[model samples]
Target: MNYIYQDILIENGDVVLDAGRNPVLIQDSAVIAQDIKHAIIESGLSVALIGEKSRDGRADLKKQIELLVEEETRLVPGTVTLEEPTLGNIWIFAKTREFGDLQFEVKEVTN
Candidate 1:
């Protein structure tokens, strides 16, 4: 089974998940990272990989994600922010987490 973070469209400066009935705000680009972070530790899912690829804080986020993945541990609650969205695929479930350079199926913008 596959779980999709539906109603999320990352435009220039807009990234938010409709989440259907509940409007989930993505705020900025970091929002994606925040969501991944929440989905991991809070989801009760194990981590496998996490890291960033930039000269900014992004690199730090990447490293952190990777650490959690390798350690198979969850980042303490409220350790990550649900702000902007990150660009990449962060794999996490009820028991594992992995980072990949692959792209997942995101619904096309309809409006």
Candidate 2:
């Protein structure tokens, strides 16, 4: 599953993530984390969405993260890999009330 998607709407803790194709795993490489943060920030969503592969959870989560030493801004820190984890296509939610049982579409970020 590819981890690529696009953010079409974000406001008042609500997101309309137009998802598709999944995202690209960018670990231990030179794809600056701040850049990713900037992308998300510019995309207008402060909280990062997280969802496990084999959980009975929805795809609209909001995560409050802490910052590391060198990294600017903050991030939804990585966790123990899901037993059947699918990379990149991290799910997002605002609240159980705000967004429920919805998978936003992820569009490509064309340069």
Candidate 3:
């Protein structure tokens, strides 16, 4: 699959992207995450949604990540091999609910 790389930034608990793409209005991080998952699955991309960390020290990041990915994919980071790069829409959702900074990358894979 070919992928268009996009970077996402979360500041003060809001999602922002470096690109000029239209912003997703849903503020709930979990719902936004689901939107991204749906976009990926609907596009049949060879990409995985991952959660790196959380602000709450006691939060179960692992469990949260597990819930995000579900049983559909387990693609590890840096393991995707693309033949040709192509542009496509990738919905990215991030949460910075604890006054912490967050960053995410969305690989808009094309098959």
User: What TM-score against the true fold does each predicted structure earn?
Assistant: 0.24, 0.20, 0.22
On TM-score, the candidate that comes out on top is: 1
Predicted candidate 3, C-alpha RMSD? 16.3
Candidate 1 lDDT over 45-71, as tens digits, reads 222222333456655554554455334
lDDT of 2 by residue, 3-111 (tens): 2332333332344343663442342211233244345545433323332343333232222221221132222233211111333333221111222222222222333
When 1 and 3 are scored with TM-score, the better candidate is: 1
Candidate 1 Cα RMSD (Å): 12.4
Q: Single out the weakest 10-residue window by summed lDDT for candidate 2.
A: 93-102
Task: List residue ranges in candidate 2 displaced over 4 A.
Answer: 1-31, 47-111
What is the lDDT of every predicted structure here?
0.37, 0.29, 0.36
Let me know the TM-score candidate 1 reaches against the reference structure: 0.24
Query: What value of lDDT does candidate 3 attain over all alpha carbons?
Result: 0.36
Compose the digit string of candidate 3's lDDT tens values, residues 26-67: 333433344445544454342322222333521343234334
Segments in model 1 whose C-alpha atoms lie over 4 Å from true places: 1-54, 73-88, 91-111
Arranged by lDDT, best first: 1, 3, 2
State the displacement of the C-alpha of residue 93, model 3, in Å, after optimal TM-score superposition.
8.2
